[model samples]
Target chain A: MSKELIRLRDLVMEFDGERILDSINLYINDHEFLTLLGPSGCGKTTTLRLIGGFLKATSGEVLFDGQEIGDVPPYKRQVNTVFQRYALFPHLDVFDNIAFGLRVAKVPKAEINERVHEMLGIVGLRGYENRRIDALSGGQQQRVAIARALVNRPKVLLLDEPLGALDLRLRKDMQNELKRIQQALGITFVYVTHDQEEALSMSDTVVVMDKGRIQQIGKPEDIYNEPKNAFVADFIGESNILDGVMLEDYKVRFFGRTFQCVDKGFERNEPVDVVIRPEDIDIVPASEGHLVGTVTAITFKGLNYDIIVEFRGFKWLIQSTDHCAVGSTIGIRLNPEDIHIMHKSEYSGMFGDYSSYSAEYDELTEDAGDEEE
Target chain B: MKKNNAILLSTPYILWMLAFTLIPLGVVAYYAVTDPVTGAFTLDNLAQLRLYMPVLGRSVGYSIVSAIICLLLGYPVAYYIAHRGKVAQKMLYMLVMLPMCMSFLLRTLAWKGLLDDTGIINNFLGLLGLPTLRMVRTPGAVIMGMVYNYLPYMILPLYSTIVKIDRRLIEAAEDLGCTPVQVFQKVTLPLSMPGIFTGITMVFVPAVSTFYISQKLGSADTSLIGDVIERFFKGNNMNLGAALSLVLMVLVFVCTGIMNRFGDDEEGGVVV
Candidate 1:
């Protein structure tokens, strides 16, 4: 097994008597690009701050390579952080900003110059050593911030939405750059972001969090396809959740139809929530498909169209290249293997009971199949 | 369209400025150079320049010393106010600026009463069975009065500038392995320079021209250029007063220029 670079065991953090990070237990392997994905106020940034030693945990221990660092000050921790605002020193030029920590350590001037130049090259900013941070573009400033943090050569680098300030195009560019840098340096990267797409595109492990609790932790594909809970399914991306009963070990029904889901945890006739990703669904020929629905609306989305199909009384948002006009009668098929089922929570609010949903869907599917004939 | 509208709107302000400001300055300039005996351009009044030169130098010296005194005393107070929590910071600043609402002359008179040989301070000291030291009618009292009168000017600007400085910069400095002292030296001091420069200008210019504070707080020997100008204008020698005013105005310009040069293009700091 790969040795864990950083481990947070039962780490609980609080602010003003309210818990911010509730009993967080996460272990990051060496050189893993682990992303903590959450919406704003989900305590992801607080998690990063805890790892960076900027804030103290209320209870629990943070271990770096097996040593407890409960009371370590920020400078003493073997970690560095890149803040969202790119908190670069305004008085220093690009080179000096990168060399700040080294100079503080009283490293020789010749060595400082060498390291600064090396960092400049690493961030693809070789000739920008003399440039003022303000003079550079947002993308350039972000690169400088990264280089500054990385130059310290910490065991783990915590980036608190470091690309949040950059525009969409630049954010995408930096996402790829960060991934490449993580691989090249072989250092643990704990990135925090509200953008699920950014986390999915770049991270080796994505930890979905909600309100100081972990929803799921898995690889990108698994988190997208095999989300373990209702919150994880809903938070990571768009999903059509239809509440139904788990009729048997492998069968589940929603929106007046039984969908063959491949999950095993359920008693017979127990209520279960069914999750179907929009992309996993398609408008198919009515004779050969699993479930059917009529097109309520169809809108263009660059390469493909967002097709909103009505099933039973509920609606299923289907993404496809098929062009279906609004109010068109269209038969739909939800791929069986794509379905996910989970235990219900009172806090999980979306679809109601599924018996009525199935009845409504069957009526719409029958109408669409007749239209196709 | 925007440019035309801006220029048109600025016309009234420009006219008011030129009428009240530029014309009076022109009148002062004419009087400063006009020959008193010949009624033509001559050095007749200029011959009396040496008589006022020492007083002018004294004014410069007093303003510099008092401004430095205010700066040293006000910096820590302003920094303390800027760093306190929201409620405490506001309350402290309110107390610091409370003196501004009171009449300046009343406050000066109160200081006079407090500093007198038989005043409350001396009485209190005597009650403590301690020697009542002489304080009033001295240069020290004058400097004290000047500092008290203009302290708010030196503090509020410094407080505003210090408050805007990002606390994260200091935290970042500490994170880079700098001690608390190094953090202040590397981050806090440089970031607060703009406020310091502004505070200096605010205190220095007023202290140099303030004659009333010196007259009330010090002996006749401590008279400043403002006192001389007041005497000349009162004696109906407006020309001499105008000449002194012109000299004071030039000194203000020279001092401000020196200060601006020192603080120009301050990093992470507002210059104006």
Candidate 2:
């Protein structure tokens, strides 16, 4: 098992009596890529800042290697951060920017030059040393920020949405590049982002948070396949969440029909939120379907069509490659493993409905979310 | 059409500059190169500048001292005000500027009142059985007057630039292993160079050429180039006054040019 590098115990952060992080307890294993995934104002970035020693928790302790470092200043910590905006020094060229940390530590001049050049090669900006910050493009500046932080060789690197400003293609490339760098360096990386896909693709462990509380923590597959609540189910991916009652172990009642599911251990006859992922539902013939619905809208995504179907006046988004005409009657099938049952939470009924869904509206909300953080 | 409209809108300012600034400058240049009595072009006025070199040197010395003192005093005040909360920053900035709303001569005269041999301070000291200090009509008094008059210029630009610096840059520096002092030395100080240059120029130019402050605060031994220029003009020696003014303008130009070079070097090269 990997050793723990950093642990936060009962950490609570408050600003003006309003809590931003509520009793957060987590341990980061050495060489693990852990992502704090949530929407804006979800305390993910606040937690990252606490780890970086930029902010002290209002109460509780931040333990680095089993030692309380609550009073340690950011400059004294062995952790660095890549800020959301990159925050490269505008007055310094690329070489000087990457060499800043070494210069501050009074490292030997020849060693500083060697390490900075190695970092430049790692970030793939080999000959852009003399280029000023504003002269570089957004992506190049982002690489400089990463290189600048990584050149310190800190045990833990905190990244707060480092790819948030990049274009789609560059963001994708950098996502993979970050994972490769983390594996090669064998250091802990605590990344924070609101992009669920990025967290799922790049992290070994995903921490889902909301409203200043961690909702769940698990591997990416487990967090996606067996969410702990409606919030996690809805936030991780598109889900059709319906209010349901547990009939017995391995059985649940929804849409006035009892369905077999893989989940158990709930109190018999307990009211629960049932989650069915969009891609998990199979389009079948009406005769063979467990339930029937009417298609209301169809959006042609690149790989599949996002079909919104209305069943008993409730809309559900379904991803299917089959082309079903608008206003046509359709059927969907869910297997025992496809059904996920979560305990009733405060977030129940707040999401999982696509009645008012539109692609443009989703994009608008995502843009607004970016600005809020 | 848009370009024409822009030029048309600037006509009043263009006309004002032509009538006031350009014409006055041309007249000064003309008088500096001409003999007053003969109305003939000659360098006699420029040749006489050597006679007042000591006065010019003293003026340069006093202004440089005042500028340095202002920088040392105003930088901390500017930095403090910039880091304050929004409401407090606004109030402090207004306080810095409040003295400037009054007339410059009145303010210098008020200092004269305070620093006179039997002025309020000395009278108060005498009442307490303390020795009366000599303050007015000294080099210190002149330098103090210049600093007091021009300190707001130093603080205003410094506050603006320091306030505009992104707080993230400071945080980035600290995260990169810099102590608080190093953060200031490596980041905040370099970024504020433009403001420093601007503040020095704003304070030094007026302090160097001011005649009224020296007149109110200095003895004959501390007479500056401005005093000599004023006396020449008052005595109807227009050619000599214009020549001194021309030399003063050149000195200010060279100083600002050197400051701009330092500022540009700090700005770094833009890789087009």
Please name the candidate that would achieve the greatest TM-score relative to the true structure: 2
Candidate 1, CAPRI quality class derived from DockQ = medium
| C-alpha root-mean-square deviation, each candidate | 6.4, 2.5
Give each prediction's DockQ, rounded to 2 decimals: 0.56, 0.91
RMSD of 1: 6.4
Summed over model 1, clashes come to 8
Task: Give the lDDT of residue B31 in candidate 1.
Answer: 86
Taking the true A–B contacts (Cα pairs closer than 8 Å), what share appears in each candidate? 0.39, 0.98
Clashes of each: 8, 0
Cα lDDT tens digits for candidate 2, A172-197: 99999999999999879999999999
lDDT of each: 0.81, 0.91
Q: List the TM values for chain B, per candidate.
A: 0.92, 0.96
Query: Which portions of model 2 miss their true places by more than 4 Å?
Result: A359-368, A371-373, B265-272
**In candidate 1, which residue ranges exceed 4 Å CA deviation?**
A255-259, A325-330, A333-336, A351-373, B1-12, B265-272
Error of model 2, residue A26, in angstroms? 1.0
Q: TM-score per candidate, in order? A: 0.90, 0.97
Candidate 1 residue A125 C-alpha distance from true site, Å:
2.2
Q: What TM-score does candidate 1 get on C-alpha atoms?
A: 0.90
